[model samples]
Target: MTSKLTLSVFTAPSRPVNGPPAIPAPQGGWTWPPTAATLIAGEREAILVDTVPTVEDSRKLADWIEASGKELTTIYITHGHIDHYLGSSTLVDRFPRARLVATEAVARDIKTEAESGNDRDFYGQMFVDELCSTVIEPEVLADHRLELEGHDVIAVATGQSDVKDSSYIHVPDLSAVIVGDIAYNDVHPTLIGSDHESRLAWIQTLSQIQDLKPSIVVAAHRRSDATNNAEVLADTIAYLQKVDRFLPGNRLQCSSLSR
Candidate 1:
């Protein structure tokens, strides 16, 4: 199968690219060090999967987008994590014409996180302290499929899984799916602010993705893997089941208790 997206790992201080692998935390070790967002450019227009955690990282993505020369028509926010959405402002600054596409739930989550004063600290830790103030509000709320650049992109909501307001962006034409934190390649999946239902939703979402028969799957957090959709779906389901089994109970524990 032809690869629809290419993944690149950006350099960071805490998560240096060439340094020794970061040791995982005792309970939930750092599965994968946070990297700048993924950029998805097609024949007609460019679509940024998720913005990085800092202005500098976002700038890198913006620079690539500008170099590509294709019109950056949309910025797809896969979830509400600060790392995914905070760098959106940098992209907006560069591509003023690009529409910020996100679900209404994500918009509400961003607003709530900003108002709660947790956003600052979240970005401050993932990125640098200087970019803690950068926040971009969504300009478009997409609850369903939207046609753009000859592709019918559907925004499937998988909320409260790895993050609140999580979503999966599927491009049927390309036979590809941009799975946010729902599935990670070679890394322990993040489980923050989630519940049993959310975990089940995440698994169900992966099942739905498998049904899409995507030729390529772009995981928001890891390097893109050239594997069948079923393999990716099975891996995600197994990971979630692992978490479920590790908990040692009939009722899967909540995100808080799991931690």
Candidate 2:
């Protein structure tokens, strides 16, 4: 008989940014908020959703995965965000057998980010010694579906959330969707670069996620202690909807929306 699947989340707490604030925040600088990686395990093997960013954080994540005593067979990246996949090299080193995979578009975006000098400077300046300088791009997933101990783990590419070619992981067995930046849980979302069209697209994406009827929704960035409540999907949609409606009238007021 096939073994039952178990899901667990490990979160790395927010850090104080070093560079100029992306938006107005406390004088101490904005806290980056926590990012979580979900591990889905069966009796013999496991699949990891995302890896934490920094070298230190990824090492800690590796230790946590090791503690599960399950062999990691796959590392699935939900999107191209550096914060989501920057420590991929560290994970790959720790789990040499685990293959890293992502959607074709996300793979391309990741490659682009890895090669971009501006991104290097930007993230390097923001994170300083805490960031992982090594970049590793995941292989393109052929069918957008992953197999974990006879279970199907589907990856759906949503057009945009906070970035282009974004996606989420849908594990039907657990009724869980690990949304990468598509939804925020009690944390300020990054929207400084977003426009009217993009916000509408984001709302549509959230609506699509809601349609899936996932009972457990995990936000990529959230409070470390927050629960994986499905309501965060609706909450994100409402936030985006409000941004769409009010952003035009008052730029300053809308800036605070992200806060």
Candidate 3:
């Protein structure tokens, strides 16, 4: 088999904001823009980490994958979030043989969200209008280890970062781990559907990833260069400590003052 597939990362052009531009804040360095996709190209198969939100963005990725001459074997949805999985349909259309792989919890969440009709509306309203454009269904519900193109793929349930079924994909050969939305770099982490235990779970997951000591760690929403397994573990621990100190009472007090 010819090794034609090439792993590439790209960032989407920033969305245009309509409001008057405010003066830049002083002192601190500017943060890097969020990366849209992280691709893994193989000799005969390719895998994508997360799909971008829009058809246009997904199509761009699809076109590049197609041009590379490697078949897209799977799209690894690290969780049930729209930003990571909504563009899956686009990939399906482009590569008929490609499978959508997610944890069982992620698949169940998609089904539940679809049946409730809130998956589109709620995520669309919160994230972007493009997220509402497609309906996603996972074809492969990964409960344990999966062997693909001579690669040992394991989807271990990390539990509670962005979604309940949130996970990390480990590729031992590459010494790489694709951690979706589990850690954010240089940005305030977003907490959703979280409880104290889940928050702790997120921290533990980070520690576990550090133990793996992957050469590269890919996060769903941060620049590709922003993280490695060790750095993510340290940064996430620090972030959680801060969250622990700022209690619900503090939030309530702040809300009261604003009103």
Best by lDDT: 2
- Candidate 3 has an lDDT of 0.64
TM-score of each: 0.77, 0.92, 0.79
Give the 10-residue window scoring lowest on summed lDDT in candidate 3: 250-259
Q: Please, what are the lDDT tens digits per residue for candidate 1 over residues 1-259?
A: 3334333333322232211235333454322344435455555566777777655656777787787777778887878877678778888888889988888788777777767868676445543234636666785564566556555677887754576457877777667777877776555576654456677777777777788788767666554333424466678789887776665334433232111
Q: Per-residue lDDT for 7-96 in model 2, tens only? A: 999998877665454555675555567888999899999999988887788999999999999999999998888889888889899999
lDDT of 1: 0.64
Off by over 4 Å in 3: 1-7, 13-35, 126-129, 193-195, 224-229, 248-259
Report the alpha-carbon TM-score of model 3 versus the true structure.
Answer: 0.79
User: lDDT, candidate 2, residue 95?
Assistant: 96
